[model samples]
Target chain A: MRLWLPPVLLAVLLCGLSAGMPALEPLFHWVQPDKQQVIYERESFLFLLQNHLLLVLISAAVGTLVAVAGGIFATRPSGRDFLPLVSQVASIGQTFPPVAVLALAVPVLGFGEAPILVALMLYGLLPILRNTLAGLEGISPAVKEAARGMGMSPLQVLVRAELPLAGRVILAGIRTSVTINIATAAIGSTIGARTLGDPVIAGLVNGNTAYVLQGAILIGLLALATDSLFEALERTWDRRFSPQVAV
Target chain B: MSVSRSESSQLMPNRVIPALGLLALALVWLLDVGTIQPNRIVPGTGHGLVSAVGWGGAALVTSTLAGSILLAFLNLRGRYLIQLALLGLSLALLPLLLDVFASRHLPEDSPFARSSIGAGFWCLLFFLFLMLIETLGRLGSRRGLELLLVVVIGGSWLIFLQSEGLESLSLVREFNARPAKFEQAFWTHLALAFGAVAISAVLAFGLALKMMRSPGWQRPILGLVSFLQTIPSLAVFGLLIAPLSALVAAFPVLETLGIRGIGWTPALLALVAYSLLPMVRNTFVALTEVPENLADAGRGMGMNERQLFFKLKLPLALPVIIEGVRITTIQAIGLTAVAALIGAGGFGSFIFQGLGQAAMDLVLLGALPTIALALLADAVFTMLAASLKPTPATA
Candidate 1:
């Protein structure tokens, strides 16, 4: 039922971004390399796009590893101590705006992807970490006891038993993180790495809203599309183990 | 679930970690001072106050130690005396650390580095000390209320009184010394924040209520808001510019209506759009969470939907609704600063100025307030949230 809203809206946004853009390419023909290329290079939008997959993949990969590990530790009585610390830290990340992180990071990392990466890492950690913690904790102890009594190794039990059970929730967290990462990545543009936010910043300066519109709509569409895709994935995963709904 | 007994037991006086960390840091310092048996055994002090990683490590260790100390203290007597002693000791150590680092030739003028490093140490200590105190006697209790009144009145008075000499604070000085242009810039920045929050609250509540009461509309509204949430703030600004420029141009009346380019109108609109989803989503979830039985009972008792919504659903959802506003408020303040990129002004005045001039101080003027604003907003909202909680049945 929820499948259509995001993608359809995204398509409309992306369509307007590309098709409705003003024909300013000809106006700047005489100065510098073509406007598009010059803007592309200057804004470094291409550079960000070039690194987009790597950024998303790395953030997701590390997030998955830490979150899962943290989740395991969190679910145990003995290892429960770190949960408050990690979640508190996560809330701090959300509460303290990304601009603050970017400001603080500038001196240490000295700008570019390092600042973006660190901010993104902090921003992305919460959902995945919290959800991993939540998902594992949500599992009934009886289910785990039954598995343990059957002689499943801890590793096997986690991988073949608990993880599958927690997959849907964990994936939801990843989806949250991913969508958040895209928005945080726009802050990257403010610092000069340039992703979808380049045109938006340019538009602000030029007083041409379309440029901002173009980039914003694309990024929005990207986030929505990705989110919708993840939601679809979530449903599919949820259905696999829940027999009543699966049939 | 309650924490284990092991968690509670760790709160006792063996708060050995901070003392040991300080000892290790001192040892490192002595070696760096050429006072050690083996030079390698002496940790070399890095230029930026014991090095970045070391500072961060020390902070983490100290925070944990502090946390453990608080845990231990809650079950002890004379906790205030204990905390006072710890504050005095840390205050005493700070000057020595400052001297050792001063001799090491780190920049004394580096407030960010120094404050951040020092704050890292202090916050963990403060939080550790206060967490137990807070949880043990949280706001609904009589003592808690007294403490609250004292702290709030004291804190507010200090800030208000201090506003007289706000320029004395180095950061605040730069803020005050900025030109008229920056002041103008600040007004626009404030307008954007004020406008965004206002619009977002209205839109969010409207949409939230609409979506919550009707399941048929849920997916689409959630998706729309989610989609709105996904849009880059910068892009929203970009998208609005062309259409708005033309619309204002056609009307001419709108310019008189206070519509302007790359200024308050569009920035406010962009921020409003950005801030909406969180509030809407939060309010809807909060309201819908009202017990189904209660709502059904209300209807059974002859309460119509409107009456029920106003009297019951709203009051119950107030806490979460306020929470969502808190998030949006913090976010809007930060985003409002970004509106400076378009020449709509506020603290972003200093941020964009600093960016332009490559002057970090200018950036700090804007950036620091923002951080403070966010923290203050969070603290105030959280306090309010505490007070709003239903009174516990003392029984």
Candidate 2:
């Protein structure tokens, strides 16, 4: 029963914010003189929300797969020597601003989801890769040796023992990557990829504070909701792993 | 042991393999293919390709080829001095090669017909980078060699700055057209990056210390900062606009003080906010990571809490705290580029302008400098942190 609290709370908060946006119109009017009571008219909140989520989901999914694969490959005996190089490349990817990536990608990919996806994937790759690498390395060698002694193959030991042990850390990485990308995906609107950033960009351009507020509020809510969901998952994983019963 | 010695002697630095790959690419693609092509406004316009041989770049090409061949022979010898000399020659030759290629190939009177650098130049630059890394790796302890390389590179760049040939390059053309604006943007970028770092560092230090004193405040403060971190810079800029404007409206004094909704005030605030997480997290970790036994020992010496913190904990944590500052400062430098979106002038203004104009070189002009700044910041902070680290004897 306690597990449902976060989602319920997030839903209520988001719904309230969205519904109350019209009432808060006067507050936004303080930003510009002409628009006394106006709401952002770019796209409906729900539609923008869906678009934002889809962008994040696609990027995070692709980013996680590639990063996890890279992480695993680097940890393998034959590939261990490349770990530093791989990590360095990942760090470089993170350090390059997503906006810059977007600017560069737009000319080649055109102004659309493709460029945004590329930028988001590159931006989100580091956390997952770093955490995955750390998680794999953190595994006690004795645990692996015991598994091998039990007649498990290397592949079996990795899939059944190693990955399961590393799941929590890897999940945390995915959470960080996904949540960060959720906010980042907003920047996609600058290049005409329809997302929550549309209102913000529009407000910025047209001096419509109401539009910016609407978009920012939604993005903030989305980030909070995703973060709470990850927290809930972490708690569940903690319960499953710990031997001691909950009080 | 003999086999190991032979292998070690025979093997070139690992970086050379990639260098060789780049050289191979240069040989196959760049030698026959165009080194520069006339930039076209219309898509798919048949601009004539100017190969290195056709563009009077044969001297540079021949030299580079000969240098690579020499490197291959010297690789087996594996002597550090020979490698260093060869590396120095390659580094010195590269800028001259670029200068010659640009001067010889690029047309002077045609503003419309810009000569874009082709695949060959890119391949050669990559090759040079690989060589530089390999040479640096081999001469790891020779800081003088690294300094010499920097001086040589800077000297060549200065020469390029005054060269008539470089004016034909699109990036240089962009700079020449708006030199004053470029200078303004550069200084603005530096000021914003450094100002945000300074403010955030102070605030972060105070907050971190407070959190340390009250253990319960740590989690909430960290959580808030991390939450701020998760908010995109664009969103933060958007969020600030309304409230900031309201503040300005209420107090005309702020407007008089240069506070506005879409400029430096909001940009600085956002940059400082974004910077706080790294600063706070680093300080918190550094403070907490101080060994309990060390603190106990200090206490045993009759030192009070203030003395213990100032004398022992701070000195030990200084390096880590500086590391935090480094990360925050670098991150701030990058984020300041995004601040240009809000009318806060920086290098990003050029980037967005270039993007609007659909000029790739102009984008590179803005982006290249920003990247250089970030890398420079990283290098400087790394050196500072290394210097601050206690020696093994002291530890």
- A-chain TM-score in candidate 1? 0.78
TM-score of 2: 0.85
Give the per-residue lDDT digits (tens) of candidate 1, residues A3-51: 5566677656555544543444443232223234323234343344446
lDDT by residue (B1-395, candidate 2, tens digit) is 36565457456444343445456545535343223435533322212224433444555455555655566556565454565666566656655655665666556666655545444555565555555554555444455776677788768777875687666666677787789999999999999999999999999999999998999998899999998987777788888988898899899999998999889999999999999999999998998899999999999999999999999999899999999998888888888888887889989898877766767667767877887788778868877898888765763
Global lDDT of each candidate: 0.61, 0.75
Interface RMSD of each: 4.1, 2.9
Which one is best on TM-score?
Answer: 2
Tens digits of lDDT, candidate 2, A49-125? 77888889989899999999999988988676456556655665566655676666664456678888888887788
Q: Write the per-residue lDDT of candidate 1 for residues B259-333, one digit (tens) a residue.
A: 975577778888887788888888888988989997998999999999998887888788898898888888898
Model 2 ranges off by over 4 Å: A1-4, A11-33, A107-110, A242-247, B1-105, B118-158
Q: Please identify model 1 stretches exceeding 4 Å from their true place.
A: A1-48, A206-214, A244-247, B1-173, B179-191, B212-215, B296-307, B391-395
Worst lDDT window (10 residues) for model 2 chain B? B40-49
Cα error of candidate 1 at position B246, Å = 1.3
For all the candidates, what are their Cα RMSDs to the real structure? Answer: 7.6, 4.5
- Position A159, candidate 2: lDDT: 97
